[model samples]
Target chain A: MPPFLYIFLGALAVVSALGVIIQRNPIHSLLALIATLMTVAILFIGEDAVVVGFLQIIVYAGAIMVLFLFVIWLLNLQVETGPTGHLALKLFGSLAAALLVTELFFILAPPHLQVKFTHEPVGYGSLASLAGTLFTDYLVAFEVTSVLLLAAVVGSVALARRLPGTDDPRAARKIAS
Target chain B: MIPLTYMMSLSAIIFAIGVAGVIIRRNILVMFMSIELMLNAVNLAFIAIGSRLGSMDGQVIVFFVMTVAAAEAAVGLGIIISIFRNRETVHADDLTLMRW
Candidate 1:
């Protein structure tokens, strides 16, 4: 990938990340997140991790985000009013983020300390190779993830389901009658 | 070719932004999105390091991370919905039922 393209995508990701923070509406924040995820997916592809990149799109950007949007619509959230937190808290948050960015810069700046790219076998990030390694080497983990997803599905349904008389006024009245 | 450090730096910046979002945002949904941002930042760093070392492990880990994140989102949102049903609000500050 070209250096300029990398820079462009990086900037795009950064800006969208900021948007996610700055937007007052959760819907807008989600849109910004979608942009960031897409940019990151492209970056992954640029790094030659094709399968990871596409999965980033199909899973993260596509399915997960749609789920988020669905929840947002279900909740019918209003636009957040005024500022989020106290001024002191906002200042502290910015200070902490700045400090973290500086620390990361110091850690990543030294070229000699960086991991150098080396030759890999052809088809490193291909779906076939990933599948081979996943099924053979990481089979247990793969199966565990499937189980986790199933559990999550069941748990979510259970949690979100309305109980008989918890908050339903009609149910309470019927029981009383 | 783009340098790996650039990718790492971008990841760090985004991660920091995510941290700030989590700290400053009061809405639970936005906070959840910020958490996702932080996770993506880590995934980006992992991919960069893995590519630099000529290994596929990082990408594979990213795959697992994405899966876990998906499950987390589902469960977390379900919890949020449950909370909303009980309280009719999604603001973190308003969720003071356990403060006592």
Candidate 2:
């Protein structure tokens, strides 16, 4: 049963990942991302880390994806041509992604790393333990994340309201609401 | 125990797919999704290692990552909306105002 769960979760992750890449429409891409996030959350669950899994679903699959969907709906964007038209931008993006992949490979490569997954998974730390670690070890990051959210709220509202040269009430209300 | 090599290879393949998407796609939103794919690929590595190491710290960090991803998506989508309003397009080629 456990092996079945593991294989199922892993396959879901890969399929949804492909879905995210293959879909062209932004809304469709967002939907694919939601599926991928959900599958990732499920993977956490299979690992017996229920809290992380739930948070993954709520924060990523729920709140974040809804925000992305709202923006996509608001924009009503038409599908654009492929990046093949712009060789420079495509080249730059490819180079950046390649650099990132290479860096990641170095970081996770087996010889340099000591940690390894074994047959016996560790017991989950209690929620209180998790919270304690988060506060003491990651307090600054926690506070900064809140500030970032606030800034995003303010910035989004502000950006949504701005008019090039004239005041626009519809735009203002759209932003305000 | 599952073979460590198999797990690593799976993650590597997934990561490669994400890199390809970011490079090949022109839509900024789709590009953003590709970024999410990359992040998830990383998360898989974290969890797999966490289980191997007999610790939950990696899982805990995954929790933190999920939070950051949410906040990032909010801000990124916000910016996308404003950009779309200004140009009425999401094409990579059309983002030339800042290009040199």
Best by TM-score: 1
Model 1 segments more than 4 A misplaced: A165-177
Least accurate 10 contiguous residues by lDDT in model 1 chain A: A164-173
Among all windows of ten consecutive residues in candidate 2 chain A, which has the lowest summed lDDT?
A116-125
- Chain B TM-score, model 2, reads 0.93
Q: Model 1 misses residue A134 by how many Å?
A: 1.0
Task: Estimate every model's Cα lDDT from 0 to 1.
Answer: 0.91, 0.70
Colliding pairs, model 2: A116-B52, A117-B52, A118-B52
**Residue A32 lDDT in candidate 1:** 100
Place model 2 in a CAPRI quality band: acceptable
Model 1, B16-41: lDDT tens digits are 99999888888999999999999999
Residue A2: error of model 2 in Å? 2.6
In model 2, state the lDDT of residue B39.
79
Candidate 2 structure quality by residue, lDDT tens digits, B17-99 = 68877877877888888888777777766666666666666776776677667767766776787777666777776788886
What C-alpha RMSD separates each model from the true structure? 2.5, 4.9
